[model samples]
Target: MCGIVGLLVKEPELRESLGALVVPMLLGMSDRGPDSAGLAVFTELLENCNSTGVVPSITRKYSLYIGQHQIDWTEFTHNLQQIGNAIIKENGNHAIVVSDCEPNLLKQWIKQHYPQLHILSTGQTIDLYKDAGNPAEIIDRYQFGLLTGTHLVGHTRMATESAVTPAHAHPFTAGEDFCLVHNGALSNPYSIRRQLEPQGIQFETDNDTEAACRFLEWRMREGDDLETALQTGFEALDGFYTFLIGTKDKLALVRDAFACKPAIVAETDDYVAISSEFRSLAHLPNIKHARIYEPAPEEIHVWMV
Candidate 1:
């Protein structure tokens, strides 16, 4: 079991509070899932990064060490600078590296030299943060109140079928500007993983949620619209699930045919929000006047900015 919450700020004014507003919703669902929690916030490109308004490139990579380990971060970062201009921001044991080099190359170099450091996610607008702890503590540690973004998705995991490692966390990124959080299990993740491996899609964890992430990324690569890709998931994926997918400008919610898992969506002029339960969204600003409803089984809700 897991807790999932998402927010799409329709009003520009609310974007600045996107992270602060979603923290309570994430915490409210903590009772449903308390083993660990994670979140992905889709914010603007870093002020130092270049932008073409299209063909977006990942400008930052979030990574961390496996355990109590130490390396000369200054020297390691200096090596990174040899490749291209870069900035490294350290937070506790994790670090967010902003660099001009391709994210794939940066990740590859880090893996090759510092095998202990594991990358979490990379994207221009998407920054993923997660850990094996309570949702409220994680939020406080990250100081979520300062996070500003157009939209965000979060997950608190109960670790039903996977380890509590950071790599096993939700809000898995499968492609540039794309990531997903799931609340349920996939019945046939192995077969699907095998089929995807040959396609050059990689698996970072045995979690079925990761398989679902790769599947969607592959479908979009084959020229399917986000909706079409999710529709195809209905045919290919066999399970009870509710998925909250985040992209650069859109947040999508989808449920399996059974819809055994719970999901509630609340919409208003200022923002659109989703949660595993109603109480999770109860504390939002101006929520009293919001239009609240539960998404039907097999129904898809896509909110675009």
Candidate 2:
């Protein structure tokens, strides 16, 4: 199994707290996955002015969860103009666009109408980084900690069922603010992918992890809350996997029907933590004591931090 870690905090200080908490976790689980490492941080944007002097500007964070696709940026901007009042900002292979409506509402609308499009990670603050090779190398190359956020999810991949590449790495994003990193295999990912294709869901890679992200998007459009979506996913899909999903407002960990994967969850008054191994929790200072348990088969464990 691959190693996974997730954290959420209300204070900015938690950014350091999370880095401190996860570094050793990644180090400890290093052997489980030596091919690639990635992390996704989710936070809300504090009031700040942009270089363009736009106040209350909306920013977006994205991850590799969305497949890389080719779209004409110029045409995309023209279309945004037709959508009424909106602002668009582009970042490294990603875009930070906003509309007159609430970001969450706008995200929901996009999911409902453009399910097939890969629009990974939204919100005022979101960042996803992954690279080919070990976690330490990837972190060093990207300066992972320099990025700030309130919630973070990370993974180290061992490449059990898929090839090793940056694009296939963990922390896959479905849209501007939704991302998921998985640590197990979906036994029947192709079948589920087929089911979603008819709904206009598209996949850039052949990995089943992308299918899971699309599944979440589809469930969210069906009016299912995060918990409901996860629980429903456990029943609807055939697989043995554990997922660590991050949204702007919530962080969730879900187990497959058989609990074939290993996951450990620990929470304190100040924060919540999940990892693929217990030793990964060794670095957490505030975790004086931890209640470690594996998720039950077909069970969903959700924490809204």
Q: Pick the candidate with the highest lDDT.
A: 1
lDDT of 2 by residue, 133-182 (tens): 87887666556555556778989988888888777888787754688988
**Candidate 2 C-alpha error for residue 31, in Å:** 1.2
Distance from true location, Cα of 27 in model 1, Å: 0.8
Candidate 2 at residue 188, lDDT? 79
In candidate 2, stretches whose alpha carbon ends up further than 4 angstroms from where it belongs are 10-12, 46-59, 62-120
Report the alpha-carbon TM-score of model 2 versus the true structure: 0.78
Model 1, 36: alpha-carbon shift in Å? 0.5
lDDT of each: 0.84, 0.70
Which 10 consecutive positions of candidate 1 have the poorest summed lDDT?
49-58
> For model 1, how does the per-residue alpha-carbon lDDT over 1-305 read when each residue is reduced to its tens digit?
89999999999998888888988898898998897888888886564633443333445645453345676778887787766556677765567766777777877888998888877777677777888887788788777767898999999998888788778878788877789999999999998999999988888889989999989989998999999999999999888899999988899999999889999999999999999999989998788999999999989899997
